[model samples]
Target: MSARPEAADQSRGSAFRGEGLRKIYRTGETEVEALRGVDLDVAQGEMLVLLGPSGSGKSTLLNIVGGLDRPTEGRLFYRETELTGMKEDEMTRFRRQNVGFIFQFYNLIPSLTAEENVQLVTDIAADPMDAREALEMVGLGDRAHHYPAQLSGGEQQRVAVARAVAKRPGVLLCDEPTGALDSQTGIRVLETLVRANRELGTTVIIITHNVGIGAVADRVFHFLDGQIARIEKNDHPIQPVEITW
Candidate 1:
């Protein structure tokens, strides 16, 4: 939430770059390779989608990129910061200020109203937009006083999106953000994400198995057997509302 002034040297290149990244989970003699030496680059202000089946390491890759998990081997650079080697405390600070996360579930407090749920983040965020403003951005201004239980699942998820973007984070990481919603609701949620990317210039990364969702991404990364099998770039992306996914 604390805004760090953009470094003079920061360019519109890779917002995140992982070189030979690997994650090994060892339990006694058996070792599980969650990531098999992944090398990928995500440009700033781009909406990128990562598609893969279960156990394909999509979530693992996202965790590593978001600084939520550290790679056992390799390097990760965020702009100029050495995120892969940073201490846990340093990583926590980095995540707090630069990253916004949206999970499959809305994760809103049961007792809080929509605005209150968002206000909780603003209170701790160093440079957050007002809760009302964030809610308005997501078309939830009229529901500010409504509780999560009173709103439909789609509305609740939109509120969740508002809370994540309120701090104006540098990166937005979404993991099956619409997994619990119907296709119609999912489309609306994706629209909000696309809007944020365009209007706020926030770098967005969505991890989902839904291949149809890739139509609106600037680039799509397909993973298989824990590695990137293909990378495709779309010169022009369809608007979120028009995308099939």
Candidate 2:
């Protein structure tokens, strides 16, 4: 997962800066702390991996960063813009304009073809690539006419990736992207994600429990008990094809 020589230059600017981030959820009498004082900086166009168990707060942090949720106490900056205090509509606009998301499930429309599914986003985006171009980026050009039910799991996930990136978002957030795929299929999905980051210069943050997948990231943030325990930088990252389960 070694980065290109130019990656360092691209990372000179901060894409996301978080300080003292904390999230507490209240379910009746129980109070659950999802994130506890998380402080981090994600460089522009950098590939970062968030590694942790189910309750370790990695997903919570990703959601907040992607503008899907807000922190209970903390400040988050996307480039120079502050996202911590944004209203719902502001957050929606921010996410629509700058962020892209890929989840464990494909979430594609069963009724639409792959290209049509991607078109759903491009139609609303300010600036977007052609639907076919987006599908081609994920190696699904030939499957553009295929419906979600006709595609394999890996293909479906790749379609999801294409749909997310069709808008040419600045940041790409993936949560357990390969959770439902086999190792071989997962590798393909990872390759698509890496291609997006490399070719499009999209800042990527992936949330996963797989230690092997972390090898592809420039930096890995390890989470434990709702907090980041440590951070590891990989001077030489391995490619997705080289990673093993």
Candidate 3:
């Protein structure tokens, strides 16, 4: 949807780098290869999108890069630190300190108000922003006192985004973040993600099935059968408002 700009200074250091990354799951006699020798580099402050159908390895790759899953074989680096070699506890710390995740489901605690839901994260994060401040960043300042059920679907999703960004993590990983919303509502989520990326200087990586959504990404990785089929670079990615909803 957009052409890639030429390399910039930020490109000199990658936010994430993976080489020969592979993930395999064996249940009983069956073995499933979730990722197959995947390799990628995500630049700092760039918006990267993963586009593929279900079971196409998009989530698998995202998980490995986010420290949620380890590659059965291969190396993963966050900047200069090798993630694949980190132990469970070490990986946990890495995730807590550097990664923020948003999923398709809101995952907000229904019993908690929007601000409280965000507070859950701020409490554990090493350098978290105020929960209300996070909500305000997503334009949900007034809704901070509302619970999940009291908010609309879009508002709930915005709360989720606020929660994720509250930690001020170095990278934000989203898996089908807009999958549960209509196009217009989805655009609002995209706008929030873009704001986080641009203003926070966080590397934003998203996985989505909607082709049009890729228009807002600086680069898109097209996945097929556990591997990246191709990558599209966009020098001038359009704003979320410009997408056909």
- Model 2: per-residue lDDT, tens digit, 1-245? 11122323343698988888999999999999999888888899999998988898999999999999899998999999999999999999999999999999999999999999999999989999999999999899999999999999999999999999999999999999999999999999999889999999999999988999999999888888888887888999999999978
Q: What tens digits encode model 1's per-residue C-alpha lDDT throughout 102-176?
A: 999999998999999999888888899999999999999999999999999999999999999999889999999
**Clash counts for all predictions:** 1, 4, 5
Worst 10 residues of 1 by lDDT: 1-10
Better of 1 and 2 by TM-score: 2
- Which stretches in model 3 have alpha-carbon errors above 4 Å? 1-12
What order do you get sorting by lDDT, best first? 2, 3, 1
For residue 136, give model 3's deviation from the true position in Å. 0.9
TM-score, prediction 1: 0.94
By how many angstroms RMSD does model 2 differ from the true structure? 3.9
- Candidate 1, residue 61: CA error in Å? 0.9
Looking at model 3, report the run of 10 residues with the lowest lDDT sum.
Answer: 1-10
Error of 2 at 190 (Å): 0.6
